[model samples]
Target: MAFNYRRIIVKIGSNVITQANGLPDLQRLEKLVDQIAAIKKSGTEVILVSSGAVASGRSLITVSDKNDSVATRQLLASIGQVKLINTYSHLFEQFSILCSQVLVTKEDFRDRLHYLNMKNCLEILLQHQVVPVINENDVVSVTELMFTDNDELAGLIASMLNAQALIILTNVNGIYNGDTKLPGSAIIKEVTAAGIDFSSFVSTGRSQFGRGGMITKSTIAQKTAKLGIAVHIANGTADNILLDVLAGNVTHTRFVPNKKASGKKKWIAHSENAATGAVQVNEGAKLVLTSTKASSLLPVGVVAILAEFKKGDIVKIIDERNKLIGLGLAEYSSDKAREWAGQKNQRPLVHYDYLYLQG
Candidate 1:
C-alpha cells in the first residue's frame, strides 16, 4: 500500500551519523538536511530525533586513564551536544531551512508541565517552518531517570505531536524474517496491528556510540504503532532513504497503526508516570472498563490497590497476572483506594475521561 503522511517524525541512529573513529560526518549530515528541506518544501512537517552526541564527544575528548564509566559518557555528551547541534544548524542553513534544538531527558516528559512546554515549543517551531532537532539530554541525566535510548524518545515525541508516522533510520534496511546475512532472508514488508517476531534476525550488537540495538527500535515501533501512528524502519545509510521512505518507495518494514485513542486518553496512556501505581482488577472490571460507556470506575470493580497514588495521578490498571490492562487518572489517593478496596458503595476510583483502554 502507498503511504502518504503530512506529519512525520524521523529518527536518525548514531551508527548512521558516525564513522568507525566515532566522528561526525558532515557530508552525510548535509545529505540528510537536503532531503529534509525537500520534504518541507512539499509542505509536510518534519521533526528529527537525532543521535550522535556521545560519539561526537568521543572524537574531541581524551579519556587517557579513566575507564568508560557513566560519568565519562555524561562528560562526553556534555561536550558533544553542542558540536552536534552546531553542525546540524549549519547544514540546515545551507538549504535555507531553519532548525531548532530540543534536548530532553526522561524527566522532561515525566513532569506534565515540562512535557507541555516541550510540545508547545516544537509546535511553534513548526508553525514557522523550522525543523526541531531533538536529542536526549544525556549530560545531566541521572542513570535511573535517563531515557533508555533515542528510539523510546522518538516514540514519545511522535505520540506527543500526534504525528502520522515515525521513520526510524538505522544502518540496516529493515527487520528480516531470518538471518539478515543469509541468502534467502526476506524483508518483512508490513505488520498490521498484530506484532511480528524477528528474534532470529535482531542484531545484538550496539552501535558505536548509541546504547540501543534492533530490539529497542522494534519496541519503539510497537509502542508508537499502537497509538495509531505508522512506523517505518529503514536504512539511513541508503541513498535518499528518508525521502524514499516518506514517498513509500523504499524497501522497509512498516508497522501499521491501530485505531486511535482519544486525545486526553492518549496523553494519559503515554504519561511517563502511569506505571508508578496500579490497581488490580477482577476479570469483570476489565470487561466493564473496556466496554462500558460509564464515566466512573465503580468501587465494586477494583480488586486491590498495589501502590500509593494521589488524585489526578495516572495509574496502571493490571490484571491478575500483573499485565497492564489499561491506564486511568486516579480519583482518590492510594490510601483512599486501600480503604475502599473490596468495599461496596464507594465512589469511582477513576473517571472514564482519565482511562485509556489497552490495545
Candidate 2:
C-alpha cells in the first residue's frame, strides 16, 4: 500500500485505547502496535504520542481519596508510565521492532536550544529505525505546565519534526456537524479553511479518559494545519483504522495544509504562551505587518515596550488595541527595544523570517 506521508505522528487518545472502566485494553494496544509495525516495515517513520498511563495506573493500585487530584495523578503517572512503556515494548517486540520511550514536559520546548535538542534526539532515533513512543512527563507536569492533552503535544511534535501528517485516533469516527449521538448528525469530511467555527455543533464535554474534548482537538488541528501539516482525526476503535485513513478510504475529518513554513516560523507558531515580552505597535505598523508585503518589526513601528525580555526570547507583538498580532524571537532585549522605540534607522526588533502571524 502506498502511503501519502513519509513521516507521521500518530496520537492515540485515552478513550481509544482504554476500556469504559479506564483500564488499558491489551488486545486493542496489540492490534494497534501490529499496524504500526507494518507501517514501519514499509519504510514510513512513525512517532506515537499515546495517552493511558493514568488509566493503566488506575488498574494497578488504588490511591487514597485523601490525596488531591494533582497528587493522585502524579502518583498514577509515576507508576503507570512503567507499565505503559513496558506494554508497548513487549507488543512491538512481537513484530521484531524497537520502540523507545521519550518523556517530556513543556519546559523542554521553552527556548530554541531546548527545542533543537529534542528534535535532534528524536531524529536520531528515527534514523536508526526506532519508533519513539512519546508521552508527556505527567509526573512532573502539573497545573499550568501541563499540556492541554496528548493531542496538543502531538501537534508540537509534528511541527518540531516537520512531519508530513498527524493522525489523531479517538473513539469517534470524526468531527461531527451536530450532536454525535443524533441520528441525522454528519461528520465534516474536510476542513480547508481556518475561520470555520464548530462551536455551535462540536461537543464541549471532555473525554471519559482524556482531559481535552473535541473543541481542543479542533483548535489544535486548525493550528497544525495552518503550518502546512495535514491532520486526520479518525476512529481508533475500528478495524484497520490507521491503514484506512492513510489509504484515504475511510470516514474521517481531514484538515488540508497551507503553504509550507520555515523551521523557525514553525516553532514561533506554537510558542504563543511561551512569550516573555510584548510590544504594542502603532496602527500603521499593524497594517503593514498584516498586509501582503513581507515585513520585519522595526523600532520605528514599535510604539511601546510592554514587557521585559532578553535577546533570543520569544516576544508577543500586539496592536494598539492590546490584541495579539503574532509571536517572534527578539533580536534585542526589552531595554534595548525601549531605548530605540519609535526611532527610525534602527535594527528590526524581529526579522520577518522569525515572525509567525496568527490567523
Candidate 3:
C-alpha cells in the first residue's frame, strides 16, 4: 500500500491511552510507539501530540481529597508529565528511535517571535531524526491560554509545521452519519470542502480521562483542513490502525483541504493576537490592496483612524463601507497615520510584506 504523506502529525487522545480504570495503558502505548518507530524507519517524519498526563497522574496518587479541581489536575499533570515522557522515551529507544518532549502553553504561540522559535526548534529536531512528542503545559495554563483540547493543539502544530496531514486517533472508527450507537449509522468515508453534519452523533460525555469529545475533534478537522492539511479521524484502539490509516487501507473520515493558504499568509491570518487599531480607507485603497501587488499602503488612500496603535502592531484595514478587508502590520502608528493621512508626500501606512488580505 502507498502511504499518502511524507510528513504527518499524529494526535492520540486521552481515551486511547487510558484504560477502564482511568489509568495509562502500557500495551496501548507500546503499540503506538512501535507503529511510529516503524514509520520513521520508512523515512517518514512524524510528530506526536499526545494527551494523558492528568489521567496518568491520577493513577500515581494514592489518595486525594481534591475532587478533580483545576488545581488538583495541575498538580497531577506536574507529576504525570515525567512518567508520560519517560514511557515514550524508553519505548522508542528500544527501536533506536530518539524522541524529545516539548510542552507548550497557548501563550507560547501568542507572540510571533516565540511562535517562530518553537517552529525552528521542531524543525531542528526533525533534522536530527528525533520525533518531537508534544503536550500542553496544563500546569501553568489558565482558561484563556488553555487549548480546548489536544485536537486543537494538533491542528495548530500541523499548520505551524506545514505538515501534509493531521491524523487524529480516537475511540470511534470515524464520524458517523447518524448516532454512532444507532443500528444503521454508517461511517463517513470522506469529507470534501463541503463539510458534513455529524452533529447528531456528537456526545457530551467527556472521555474517561480526557476533556474533549468527538465534537472537539470535528472542529479541529475542519479548522486544519482550511489551512490545506488533510485531517483523518480513525480508531486508535484497532490493531494496526495507524499504519492502515496512513497507508490508505482503512475506512476513516478524511477532511480535504479547501483553498490552501500560503504558510506565511496562514500565520498572519491566524495569529492569536488581535490587531491593535484600525485604518479606515476608501474603496480605491481597498481595491488596490486586494487586487494589485502593491508594496505599501499609500497615505493618500487612508480616510480615517478608529483607534490608537503603534508602528509594527497588527491593525485592521477597513473599506469606506466599514467592511474589514485585511490585517497588516502598521508602518506608522495611529498618531502618525492621523498626521500623514491626506498628505500627498507621506509614506505608506503599512508595507505589503506586513499585510495579509483576507479571503
lDDT of 1: 0.83
The prediction achieving the highest TM-score against the true structure is: 2
Work out the TM-score per prediction.
0.93, 0.98, 0.84
C-alpha-based local distance difference test score of model 3: 0.84
Quote model 1's TM-score.
Answer: 0.93
Q: List the residue pairs that clash in candidate 3.
A: none
- Model 1 per-residue lDDT tens digits across residues 290-342: 77465457778778888878877778888888888788888889998888887
- Each model's lDDT comes to 0.83, 0.93, 0.84
**Per-residue lDDT for 99-188 in model 3, tens only?**
999999977776568779999999999999999999999999867778889998898899999998899998889887777677998888
Rank order (by TM-score, best first)? 2, 1, 3
TM-score of 3: 0.84
Please report the candidate that would top lDDT against the real structure. 2
Give lDDT: candidate 3, residue 66.
52
Worst 10 residues of 3 by lDDT: 265-274
Higher TM-score: candidate 1 or 3?
A: 1
- Residue 71 Cα positional deviation in candidate 1, in Å, after optimal superposition: 1.4
